[model samples]
Target chain A: MEQPVVTTKDALLHAAGALFAVHGIEGTSIRAIAKESGANIAAVNYHFGSKENLYLAVIRHVLEKTRCHRSEELLKHRRDWEGKPLLCSEAVYRIVEEYIQQFFTGIHPRWYGRIFMRIFLQPTPILWEIINELVMPNFDSLREVLQCCRPGMGKEEADLWLDSFIGELMHYVFAEDFLLIIPGHRKLSDAGYQKDILRHVAKMLIRGLELPVPVFLQEDIVHA
Target chain B: MEQPVVTTKDALLHAAGALFAVHGIEGTSIRAIAKESGANIAAVNYHFGSKENLYLAVIRHVLEKTRCHRSEELLKHRRDWEGKPLLCSEAVYRIVEEYIQQFFTGIHPRWYGRIFMRIFLQPTPILWEIINELVMPNFDSLREVLQCCRPGMGKEEADLWLDSFIGELMHYVFAEDFLLIIPGHRKLSDAGYQKDILRHVAKMLIRGLELPVPVFLQEDIVHA
Candidate 1:
């Protein structure tokens, strides 16, 4: 089958995202992006108005693409759980599992992660917008889920635990290459290894929070 | 007393480290380093031979400086523990605490961390050498300490757990800036906050590994 034609705007964003991932914002030039995308400099200006706008567009494009996929999966999950009552612990496990799988496996072209790491290391002005608009709602949902798991858990304490949980997962995401150097470490690309990580993280969170284990995870806890 | 004079090579390494942290390896130029360090381009060539060599020298300088301080602290801890049977749990706690503090606070000028992060994200050919020479020794020590904590734990399991532990700590180190945007988050620079993080990490690891809590940490576990 013939491939659909890629618009100049999409091509520019893709090219800019890859270059920015490697050289960073200030390091990457409009001319380089234009050349990489096979578009003229004037075309870049016409499409995105400026390099900064183009950078923001690239970030938005990646985030929106991921967010759309996540929303669909989450919608499916909600539909599946509609008639069945999920224990809070089970709910948290599923949430974390879905998050890990989607984050590590669902994102594509690799540059998406690099772009995120670049912005994470050196945040731009749009960071506040991205956090509030795209990140905060998900964080709020996770926080609410944790509170449901352990009633009377103080907001501050719950937030800290959530941070620890996220720190563990983000570390693996960001440092996969570094982690692989350790003896006997498995590839994140391995589906079984991903499940192992999910169980490992869930075990740590459930135990650390002193929450009652769901029946599904009880066996793993014993062996762990 | 008059301030000590900085040598030409030291100046170049310092400048290169800072610039590389901002612009990355390929993005930075030798002329920029020379200008920033107030040395001529010829002087840079005379001192470090090449930009790549200068970059490696910067890495070596930062690692050695931190290692020296770490060695001193470890020596002091050993001396203090002499003739007293230290619990494996306590040893692990102390090692992790020292690591977090040294990694986050002991390194000076801030640019050191930025340089490390840059290298971490965009690894150079020297990464393997660094893994073997600097990182592996510390990792080995942690692994041994963990094994002492939990006898009969498989090497692969122990390694996975160690990665999770390191992942938690590293996430805090790497994502400190992004994390601060979260509501109710504390500054990493705060000494008290660092202790809270240390305790939080220890609690998670101890529970996750099912290790017996040392007498000193028993109270915290109860409250936790």
Candidate 2:
């Protein structure tokens, strides 16, 4: 039988990434990562040189995997709907369904998701760098899909609607603690439940997009 | 003019609340709170008995204020629309608009908001306690309003739709970091923009409730 080999560096990266995801970078210690990985402190120092470098590398590694996986999904969606122009509602539905998959059941490790959420909650300078390289391409892809759904939708308008959709999707995933506490609410363990919720969310987004922009009230103007 | 006197306990709670909002409970230190509040370590000990107690107290204090303020607004809404039947759209719009205001521009201090978001992201045992004592009452109120909007809606169905609306609102506030990065996206500082977004979200939610549940596809069944 062939034995799979795990590099000391890979082990350290995985451990560090998990820790950093649960506990923000400032909250985690190098010693904890070393202990969790079963790597000596010297080995960690030799591999990553510095904690900051290791943190950045871990983010890069996780994001690289996410970007590649999501890009493929986007392509798959395009192929599935090829030659036929999807209706506005269909396009939005597909886009949201894809997002729901990514947010709840994507290939990224559970802890890896924590790192992404942490950055959003408590942003570091590195977030901008990640956004530019990793996030923007994916966001642009979604934006393009949305534009196809609603032709002539301005980027600014799309941005707001897109944010609303993404926000709600993220909340479903991120606010599980709060959600679980609500009377009669269940944990999203069943894949069937996830799909149903996603469809519901997609419908909401489509409806939201169709609503008229309200005329600004004087109070709103004064506040603005 | 009479000057109000603040107790040592109040000082500690105020400082601790701010720090905990910015940093998670695990990330914050007793010494930091003591220093920030200008109350010595001895005073902190004398007042709260322990760090855990102090932390709980701070959360309780913030939540107590939030509950009172939010309850008043909800009552005001009920009173304003008294004797007149509110359209489903109007009820949803009012509910969502109120949420946006409380989230982005509510009476609770900015830092207090952080503690709530943190609980959602990184849950602790205290969250269950808070949810039962503080959050449930408010959520029930929303559910009541929603039931009025869609008369005879089942509790289970209402829970799902309500989650969609709350999830979207929470996302807008929590995902500001990501939103700021999106090209053409602007800060949600304008009251006019806030109202428009609230109306948009409410419309989507109302539409979503009216949407027929999609038939499960073969692929979805397999995947589920």
Candidate 3:
């Protein structure tokens, strides 16, 4: 029987991606990448030209994977036989489920988890490119949903609505520390907690984006 | 006359905070903090106990300042005129402005910046306390404002509205990366962008958080 093998360049990018994700772009180095990938020093220079590009390559690879998986899921609910546009919250819910699953259950979820967080936090030129092409497109549908869900609303207002929606999604991503602080990390991961979060976030979006206007919302709108 | 002497401990935290903002938590270290602070090794330990604690202290100090400053601003507004029910959007805008200004400008603002980005991208334990004590209280007031405004909405709906409001905020905080990716960061900071953001955000909240009975509103809500 023959053993399976992956290309050194692929392995290099994979290893480097994890390292960069954990330590960050500047904190990672070519030598470290080479050491992890089991590749020679010169090979890094040959395959990717430099460590920066290699880091970019790693990010692009992960972004591609994440996008593909997410889109595939998004596409699944496309018609449901009736051909009505996907319910806006349901669309978001699909992404939410996949997002939590990919980062929590997948084999290399943790590897990309920190890198994805770092990339969003400390964006690089290449990181921007990935986001522009991949993530932003998905968000466009969200914006559309908000627009339809919110008629007579200006672009700015819809954007804000989406902002809150994204923030809720993000809380899940960054909630570990908060969970620990609330002394809820263990419970936060429990079935009840996960269900609560799912329902809570979903409910918030449904209520905030789909509900009516309020009276006490008047304000000076003046600078403090 | 003796000059107001900045203590070594204070200087160390200040320097470390600034460095951490620029270089990030993992990118920064104790030695770099010491070198930047001109503080002795023993002084670093005596003041902070450990590098991690220094980071936390930096976060705590910066967050306390922001909460206090913001509270003062809100209080000043309230003192001059009380029982002024601000629209959720207006409340959000004022909060956003102060939040941006304080984080972008102030002594040791760098720590706040680092923590701001860190909280979204790489949450830590200290950030949670900052969220609950320093931040959550402010939202609690906003919560009341929402209650006063949207008199008929159920608890679930109001909580949902709050979640969306948070989304609006996180987008601004994390939007630098996304905006740049969209080639919109520069535009976002522009006068037109700010106006657009303010109007849209305010509009969305006003309409989205409306009560079941309906009230004064620029527009009506459209459920998806």
Candidate 4:
């Protein structure tokens, strides 16, 4: 029997993603990646053709994996909801709860957050490409769910609400270090804290969607 | 007349802040700082004593500056609210609005966001120090405002709401690049968009605070 072998492409992508996360694209060297992956410079060249291509491939791989995981989560919730349609607030809670679970699961590879943060903070042309191909379609699908829950909601208002919802979760997922550092404070590290955050945020977002327009925001919303 | 001179300490800090933002603390070197600042290596050693010390000093300087600016804003709002004590929802709106203004002001030094992002996402012992000395006090003060707004709100609940509020602002301030890249969607770069976001989040958070507790979260609140 022959031993299993990892493909050169996968090896290069794994090594590149980790290195890129730490050193960034400009700071990382092809020679270093080749050495780290236990592949020769020739193999790296043959597989990726160039450093830029390798970086893009790594992003694509991560995006695809993330999409699959998230889509499954979304679809599962939708399927459950279909059996007995959830009230608007209940649906909102469930959706946000799933997001919190996914965010805090720590299942992603170590370098995934770094790579995601880099692109999010300092976007380039490649970011536009990724958002168009990977992010927006999924976003639209989620937006539809939220909109269905509140038929009276306008699209712009709904979009803004969704952005806020996702934004809050992003901070928890990406900036937990900042949140956790405050001494003597309640840490999100406590058991069930993530669930609490989910409950709080979902209630807030759903209420926000349903609340009568405050007079101050009326002018702003009109223009918006 | 004698020409005014920039001190070696100021030069080193400015250079180090920029370099650290791009390459992170470990990746930057004293040699690079010296060269960039036009100060000799001996001057760098004499002023900061070590690279780590200099890094800590830079964080302290930034935190102090940011704290001062934010404190002024909060104080101004409080004074105005004193003359006409704002309603809970109105106060929430104003506080959030001020935050959005500060976040998008672009008045902070160029490297501020990058350096802040690095320390925030990837923590070091220095992060703990910075959070203790600079972050927690300001956070506690803001938490008080939120607590005052909703008299019935518990400490845990207020803290959760505050986190969600700040988290939404962080996305706008830090992740604007990602926001702007979505094709055919409204970009934060559009005029008055930040204002709209401030309004949206303030409304959502206020409404969420006032909304009746969902059944699932009721148990968590009791335990909380």
Candidate 5:
């Protein structure tokens, strides 16, 4: 195996992602990224080639960290890494919890997802392909985990489940503005309860994944 | 009889709202607002008192339109405009759809919310107060609708359901910049597909509302 890469490129990406998150892709520049990373401007040019590629590299870096964190969390709880796994609901629970704690409000506190949203909504053919292929596949693990939770549902139903799974994940990641909401309803502070957003979210997912009461009485009697 | 005041402030707000939707709050100005509305700069100052106030007024104006539209949609489906109730599910659907459409290329658009999110992740107390009173109530309507759909779940479960509901709403709304995954995913060339979005969304929402197999087994007797 390649002895892996040096942390120079990694540090550049880290500095670049924070700057980009705060100022956005257009607002942040190569000069600033070079200055912040303590790397020579030529080094940036040498590695990423341009500011645009640097931005793309920065995004991939953060995504890889996120993916690895969740993957490790899921695998550690399970006995094996690759197998036909019966996913613990707790596995889903931890992914969400760790995602909230480690990523959303983590060191790179600012989120540039709105910028991503802005570009994607323009439906730029390039962005569309990334979302359809790269991002959506991130949730395939969730779909597999969710499958064990709801076996009777059809493929269409399973697809819909993935939609909600990804949808909730999307909103939580991008809609950090609403983080105050947990407290806004007095659901957090004056309500005399400790904040347990992860628990609430996990329980809600379970409810949504489970089946509803049957519409027909005759069918209900035999089924029940 | 107390007639509604036709103050310069109201005119400034009205004019600002339309302009901001097109040019964005940052893109629009007091001078243009005065020019278009046939009001002078001092007239804008007299009403909005400041540019920021004018911008906020624009936001409030669009949000008010959203609320009014929802009221009308639900009322149209109701016998008594005041007493007629929209099903919680329908209400959630309406709020989510309307809110998404409000930003996703619609009759009334305000880039303020998107811009505002960047500025105010940790919003001022006033903004939080306003959102709690306005947006949170809309969210509760969604919660109630899901509750009506799945009455057996506990409150904790419902919290997760709301999380997913908000996610779906935000996903489609913010999907403009989805290129991170879909490399070349761009906007649909055809505007007609926007309706098709609503159909897929409606289907997705229904799936989120459905329970899993354990719950399904509990209701298998039902034809649905």
Candidate 6:
């Protein structure tokens, strides 16, 4: 596993990210971030120019760090399938599986997800920029894959299915604690439990979309 | 439409709930709550005893107000099916549909959902009380309905299915803003759009759980 490199800038970003997640940007002060990071207040100004700029940097850092793995997987899938006949249903399953895996594995140290959750719950001016620049491209690519799976599907229907699919996966991210209270529930960190979720959500998406289940997934479709 | 009655106590609860949702408990003060409610600061002490108790009261208010309809619907389902041969699949569908309807209609003025979201994202001691006292009973009841729909299902498997089912619906509540950004997407408050989502999620749960499709829902199961 590659460890994240820690420089003054990285330390500042990490500290600021944690603070911002706990308290909104307006509530978090540069002095607290600096103190937490073991860097001086002057360092924040010198590096990010202003508190708002520091916040923007923190958001960008979070997005880049958390999304890097999923983006790479998406690119690899596209590259591998180039000029080949695509198994649309299999591709869709792979995408959903990979997304769930990335969500659990990629969002490390936990605070990274909290930052996004805070932003989602309490929108800031920067949210629009993040949506347009970062979120939409990823959403559009996923939609394209879904469109391939269900030919002639209108954009409106595709969007609804996409929302439902992503919504299920994102719920685990958002409400992991709440779900843990169920009797016989295992921690999401349990590898076996993670595998169960990955399979469960991917299967849900495939069936919900009415895609023909690939032969590999048919074995797991047995009713409880 | 029945309007929420606004006594001074109700006014205080409403104002405090919104502030707590936005700023969280530690960040919000009784003085601010009193000012927002147009009541004197001493009124907070007199009515709720202290800020912590007031916070507790606000949470109770939100939960009671938001969940009252769903509880009634669940009771109605139980009462209607008493001493009758229950179609388990139909019962499960009705529970899911009524839950979704309650989510949209009962969580009115919006801040109620936000208060829960905030608590979910940033848990305090009250989360345990909420989960054990309020959340678990509702969860257990739903799981019972689900087990009826799938006989011989183990507790663990039933829990997984219940989590996935509720996760999909809760996602719409958590990510309403993100979903709205999709092109051609209608506001969730739009009755037509709400109907589409209610149908989409109900169908997804029915199919994902591999429940026997109730004849009433078969018409909407065609692939796009």
Candidate topping DockQ: 6
> Residue-wise lDDT of candidate 5 within A24-78, one digit each (tens)?
5655677888898888877777888887787666665545444524634464444
Model 3 achieves a DockQ score of 0.28
Which candidate number has the best lDDT?
6
Point out where model 3 deviates above 4 Å.
A1-7, A29-46, A68-108, A185-192, A211-224, B1-16, B25-57, B68-111, B119-168, B184-224
List, residue by residue over B3-50, the lDDT tens digit for candidate 6.
Answer: 674788878888898898777776688889999999999988888888
Model 4 over residues B1-224: C-alpha lDDT tens digits? 11233888888898999898776676687899999999998877799888888988888777776562343355456645533333545666666766665555555665665666776756777568777777777777777777665666666766787788778777776676666665445665454565567656766666665633223222211100
Residues forming the 10-long window of minimal summed lDDT in candidate 4 chain A: A215-224
Candidate 6 CAPRI category: medium
lDDT by residue for model 5 over B25-124, one digit each (tens)?
A: 4457779989877788788777667887776666555455555246335534543322222343455455556655665544543343443343233344
Q: Per-residue lDDT of A108-137 in model 4, one digit per residue for the tens?
A: 665765676767756777667776787777
Candidate 3 per-residue lDDT, tens place, B17-36, comes to 77876677678877888888
- The model with the greater DockQ, 1 or 6, is 6
In order, the Cα lDDT scores of the candidates are 0.69, 0.66, 0.58, 0.66, 0.52, 0.70
Tens-digit per-residue lDDT, A14-92, candidate 6: 7898898777676688899999999998888888889888888877777766562343355456646433333555666
> Which candidate do you rate higher for lDDT, 3 or 6?
6
Ranking by TM-score: 6, 1, 2, 4, 3, 5
DockQ of structure 6: 0.50
Worst 10 residues of 2 chain B by lDDT: B215-224
lDDT of 6 at B157: 69
- Per-model TM-score, in order, reads 0.82, 0.79, 0.63, 0.71, 0.55, 0.85
Candidate 6 — what's its lDDT?
A: 0.70
Task: Put down candidate 2 lDDT per residue, B1-224, tens digits, no spaces.
Answer: 11342887887888888888777767788889889998997877799898878877877776676562343355456656533343445555556666777666645566766777776776666657876887778878777666655557767556767687678777776776567776667676666566557655665676655532222211111100
Candidate 3 global TM-score: 0.63
Against the true structure, candidate 4 reaches a TM-score of: 0.71
- The runs of at least 3 residues in candidate 6 whose Cα sits more than 4 Å from the true structure, single-residue gaps closed, are A1-5, A23-32, A49-51, A68-86, A219-224, B1-5, B26-32, B68-86, B220-224
Each prediction's Cα RMSD? 5.2, 9.9, 8.8, 9.5, 10.0, 4.2
Quote the B-chain TM-score, candidate 3. 0.67
